[model samples]
Target: MNTKKEKPLHSLFAGATAGAIEAFVTYPTEFVKTRSQFEGKRESPIAIIKDTLKTKGVKGLYSGCTALMAGNSLKAGVRFVSYDHFKGMLADSQGKVSTPRSLLAGLGAGMMEAIFAVTPSETIKTKLIDDAKRPNPQYRGLIHGSVQIVKQEGLKGIYRGLFPVMMRQGANSAVRFTTYVTLKQAIQTRMRTGQNMPTSVTFGIGAVAGLVTVYTTMPLDVIKTRMQSLTARQQYRNSFHCTYRIFTEEGILRFWTGTTPRLVRLMLSGGIVFTVYENIIAVIGARSPDK
Candidate 1:
């Protein structure tokens, strides 16, 4: 009869675990998503997939599943923890929740999440995705790719697109969470007394937020992809050198090449990711045999 227990903690841990598992399960699609965004004149996603399947089969899709799991575990864990902590911080500072405070919650959560988890994850994730469709194709699998990148480029190599990921993902978290909170409150108030916002609305809001973010950050993403994946880790010798070359040579437009696919991926990915995470949290709380 000992029901006085920690349900939110379980939900939090479950959400993190689920998110990490989902990252790996969807690794291939994510790999495709990233590659689809990084293509240029002669590079097409279909061509990349066909070539990859022809050359590698299932391995192509699951290329970065391991790195993805690690990335997502940390990424999701930090996100959930930060959102909770940030919300608490805001509540304490401002005395109560308001629309502006909700938005601030999103902004702070996104910034901190990126600072904590984007670099190493993006480096490994991008490299794995890139190697799958690389012109010369240097890696055999995620393991080999990761090992080679580290050995040749040192520990720094694994964080190639750190800044861009931080920018894009940070903005993404802020926008997505803000949209979610705003929509949730709007829904709550609009309904007469007992009604709550429907799940579909939450998803829609998340999609909108994701769309806004991806479009804004698409250019930076393309550059980051090229810099992280296509470029040699050892060649740049440092992140700054690689970034400088991309900026000076590729021009600005080149930075936005794979924008369309990225938008699509973000919309779908963001909606599902937030929706799933939220639902899973709810389920854990409800099902835990505790008050």
Candidate 2:
């Protein structure tokens, strides 16, 4: 087993690489998920895809890919670096992290990423998607859209849905990390493989973690998307108000509006991200003189 401590830069690079790969591969699913949430009336994923392709062509399915790709890279970098930093601090003298400590570290990482990377990127992506649906699209591209949003609504516009984003991300990381680590450890112990499990094993574990995260955090995800939307100010006064409106007007099940597409995206995302990140980190460690 490699015992070398992972440098922050390595984690950042590995995470960023993993995130970008995951985002690009699963962007169409993300597009469908967002569109599903955008509508007041529920639409199946099949219907959404057909409509988008019919009206806007194949490129429409990647409407916000650039913003998400960039954001996911930055967000994943920050999240992994922060998680490692916090985990190191909370590790016992033997360098073992308990589940509770792991959860805390994940929470910290999630909150940090939400504020520094997720909120702004997600706001931009959501807004772009919203604008694209308009008959007369207001924003031409990512840079122009970002500029227009800031110009019209100021910094607050770019940071819309900060509260729900933080909540959703925090819970997501806490659950994902803890679950992944626990399952990995259990499988390692059973297999006596130590920390050098096969890539397939890592991917499977990560998929399970993503599955858990999607269900647990779906409601928060919906609220965050809604809050960051173009019509949020007119539709919802705040996070609580948004939740109330979703529940009262749209019904309780509405909170999971995009569950199918989101689930598919995240499952593939988890598998791809963890597999890529772990492999990169391993390669980095092997190249280190100290290893």
Best by lDDT: 2
After superposing candidate 2, which stretches have Cα over 4 Å from the reference?
1-5, 193-195, 286-291
- Indicate the residue-level lDDT of 129 in model 1: 77
Sliding window of 10 residues with minimal summed lDDT for model 2: 282-291
Q: List the residue pairs that clash in candidate 1.
A: 28-61
C-alpha TM-scores of all predictions: 0.78, 0.95
Give the per-residue Cα lDDT of candidate 1 at 223. 54
Q: What's the true lDDT of residue 174 in model 1? A: 72
Clash pairs for candidate 2? none
User: Residue by residue across 127-169, what tens digits does model 2's lDDT show?
Assistant: 9998888888899889999999999999999999999999999
What lDDT does model 2 reach? 0.89
